[model samples]
Target chain A: MSSGKHYAKGSPKPVLPDDGQLRLFSMRFCPYAHRAHLVLKAKKVPHHTVYINLSEKPEWLVDVSPLLKVPALQLSAEKGQPSLIESLIIAEYLDEKYPQNPLLPKDPLKKAQEKILLERFSGVSSAFYKIFLQSSGLDDFSLALDIFEQELAKRGTPFFGGDKPGYVDYMIWPWLERLPLVEFALKDYKFDAKRFAKIAKLIELLKADDVVKSFYVTPEQHIEFWKSRRAGNANYDLLA
Target chain B: MSSGKHYAKGSPKPVLPDDGQLRLFSMRFCPYAHRAHLVLKAKKVPHHTVYINLSEKPEWLVDVSPLLKVPALQLSAEKGQPSLIESLIIAEYLDEKYPQNPLLPKDPLKKAQEKILLERFSGVSSAFYKIFLQSSGLDDFSLALDIFEQELAKRGTPFFGGDKPGYVDYMIWPWLERLPLVEFALKDYKFDAKRFAKIAKLIELLKADDVVKSFYVTPEQHIEFWKSRRAGNANYDLLA
Candidate 1:
C-alpha cells in the first residue's frame, strides 16, 4: 500500500486545490510525516495526505506551517483558521478527533506513563535523526539507544502497550522502522537484534503489520533517499 | 501559601521515611517542577512534595530519575515502581490520577490545541531558560516570546482557556512566573506589558489566585537564588 502521494524531485505539485476535508501536508519520505501516516492507519482515521516538495516548497505551505515542516493538518480552510503543526500533537489529535479505535488508554496514569515514554524516547529519535543529519554518532547517541532497548526488556511486554500495539507502540514505530537506514549508512552503528531482543521483536511485529506493510521501505531505499537529500535534491523513490 | 517541603541548602534529609502516598520530587526555583506544583494545586490533589537540592541531587533522586532530573513523582515505594519524570507528564498524571477537578479540557480538539501551544511555548521556555543560564540574549530567544505574546493576543482570551485557567495555563505559567527574573537579569530583555497585554493580565490574575499567591516568589528572591546557583551554591530562600 502506498503511504501517500509522492511529490518526487523535479515534479510539479498537484494543480487541483484542496477540497477541505481534513488534509495533511506531508512529504512521503519524511519520518515525521510517516508518524502521522502510522497514526492514521492505526486509528483508521479517514484523511488525505498531500506530499509536499520539500526542496521546492509551495508558497501556500509556508503560510500554513509556522516552521515549514511537514505533517501539518489544515484544520479548516476558513480565513484565520491556522493549520496545526507537530506530529505527536497531530497524532493525538487524530486519536481524539476520531474515537472509533482509540490508540490512547483512557486511564490517566497509563496515559501519563506513555507520555513519559514518548519524552524519554526523544533521545532515541534525536540520535536516529542526528546520525544521518549531522553525520556524527560517536557520542550522546549510543547511550540513548541503550536506554531504549533496556527499557523495552525491563517492561517485558512484547509491544510497549503489551499484547497489542497502543499509543506507545504507534508513537515510536515510525522511527524504529527507520533504524535500519541508520545502520546501513553508519558502518559502526549496527542494530544488534540479539542484544536488543524486545526491540527486535517489536520491530518484527511492526513490519508484519498490515499498515506498516503498506508503506514499508527497506534500508537501501531509505539510503537512496538520504543520498539525494544529502546531495541537495531529495524526493528520490526509495521504495520504487 | 506553601508550595511544598523544601530541602534547604546544607539542611539534613527528612527523617520521615517514605510512606506510599504520592510524593513529588521538586525544586522550588525550577519552572518545570513548578508546573507539577501548579497542577496539583489546581486539582486540589492530596500529595506531598519533597524539594530536592538540584546542586547536590541526593543519591536516591539519581537512582530513581533516569535523566537525574527533578519533578520525579514516586508513584509507589514498591521495588519496581519506576519514578515518573518530566513535569508535563507528572502534571497530566496528577490530573488523571486524582479526578476531583479536571485540569485538561474535556474536548479532544481543545486538548490538542493546548498541546500544540505547549510545543510552541517550548521556544519561549528555552529562550527564558537560556538567557539566564547562558547569560546571553542573542538569537531565537526573543522571537519565541514574541510569538507567544502574539498567539496570546490572537486567542483573545484573558487566559489561554477562556473563563478560567486550564491545562495550557498551568503548563506555561511556571515560566511566565519567572519572566520577571529574566527581565531583572537581562536589562535589555524586558517583558513589554503593553505589547503583551493578555499575558500581563494573565500574570496579574495568576498573582491574585489563591493557589498561585501561596507559591508566588518575588523577582528579587528569584534573582537572589539565581546569584547563588550562578555562583554554584543554590538553595536561596525564594519562599522566605
Candidate 2:
C-alpha cells in the first residue's frame, strides 16, 4: 500500500519492515498531523508517513498508539514498542531528539513565550471554527484576527521565531493555509490582508518555504475536502 | 495585600517590589493553578503567590496576563514584562530555569513518553468532571480509572516518575487529590482500592510528599468549595 493512501478499517495493516525508521500514523487533512509533518520536514527527521482513516480506524492502531489518535510517531519498526501520540509532543520529541534545525529557542523564557503564543492562538482557532464550520461568531473571529495582527506587530520581526519560521510558525501554518478556504466558502467573509500585513506576509513566506511546499494542500483542494466532509462523505485520500 | 489573600475586581493592584523574584498569579482552588503550585513547590523555585478571584478578576490582571488566567508566571518583578501562562508551560519553564530538582527526564524519549502519559490521563480528568461535577458518565469514568490502573501497574513504579514524583505525577496530582471528593459527593460511588491497588498506593505516596502537603486542600475543604461553587457563589479565599 502506498503511504499517501489512508488505510481504512477493511484494509490489511502494512507490515513494518525490519529496517529502523520512524513511522508516523497520520490523517492527511488533520491539522494536528500537519503539525508533526511540518516538524519532521523542518528537522529533516528520517521518518515514514502512514495516513490512517480516522473515521474507520485500522484495528492494529491500538498497538501503535494508546490514544488511538493520528499524529502518533512510532520510534522504530519493532513490534510492542510504544508510539508517541499528541502532535506537539511528537514535534517537541523530534526537535529534542534531532537537534539539527532547532525549532524552539534555547532560552527557557523565550521558549515558553513561543509556547504561550501558540496557546493564545487557540482563541483564533476556536473563533475560526465557529465562523467557518458553524457559520457563526464572525465578530469573534474578526476580533481574534485583530489580536493575532497585533501580536505579530508587537513581535517586531518578520517571523514569530525572529527572522526564521520556527516553532510557532510551523505550528500555526496549518490553520493559516486553511484561511483562504473561509473566503472561498463564505461570500461575506474575507481576511483584510492590508490590515493584517504581518500575517499576510507570513502566509506568503510559509507558503514559499520548501518544507511546507512538500505537504502543502491547495486552497481549492482544502475547500473540496471540506465540502465532501460537510456532505457526510469525507475523501481522506484526496491526494491518492 | 498579602500573597495568600484572593484579590478581586475592586482591589488595587499590588506594587512589584524592586527585588527580582518570580510571582505566580493563581486561584487557590483551581486544579490547573495547583499544577504550577505543585511544580514550584517540588522544584523549590523561589516565588510568591498572588491569589486572584476568578469570578471577579482584578483590573490590573491584563498587565500580568494577556489571557487573564491563573497560573501565569511573571519571571521577574519588572513591570511591562510578559508573564507566561498555561500550567504545563509554566511548570516546564520553572523546571528549565530552576534546575535544582529536575521535574522532567533528561532523555528526550523518556520525557516525551511522560508527556504522552499525562495526555492520556485527560480522559480520567474529563470523566471525573462528568461524574462528580455533572452527575453523569460513571461508566466512562470507571473505564478511565481502569486504564489508569493498568498504566500504573505496567510501570511498576511507586510514582508516575518512578521512585519519586516527577512531571506526570505533579501534573496529575491535582485531579487525583480531588477524586475523594467524587466519592463524597456521589453516595453510590467508591473507588475499589483493591482493584486499583497501584493507583491507590501512588495517590498515598503523592499526598504524603512535602511539596503536596504545603498546598494540600483537605477533601472536606474541596467539598465545601465545590458546594459553594455549585451554589453560584464560589468562596475563592477558603484559606484566607
Question: Per-residue lDDT for A56 in model 1?
Answer: 72
Q: Model 2: per-residue lDDT, tens digit, B30-101?
A: 999999999888877777788899999999998888779888888775456669998989888888988888
* After superposition, candidate 2 runs with Cα above 4 Å error: A1-3, A77-80, B1-3, B77-80
Report how far off residue A170 is in candidate 2 (Å): 0.7
Among incorrect, acceptable, medium and high, the docking class of model 1 is medium
DockQ of each: 0.72, 0.92
Give the alpha carbon lDDT tens digit for every residue of A19-90 in model 2.
678898999889899999999999887777789988888888887876688889898844566688888898
Put down candidate 1 lDDT per residue, B1-240, tens digits, no spaces. Answer: 224446544665554445666677788888888888788788776667788777666665665576778888877644566688888778777776777767777676677777777888888877776787776753566677677677778888777777778888878888788787787767776677786677888889888887777667877778888888888877534563
Alpha-carbon lDDT of model 1: 0.74
Clashing pairs in 1: B1-B214
Candidate whose lDDT is highest = 2
- Give the lDDT of residue B151 in candidate 1: 73
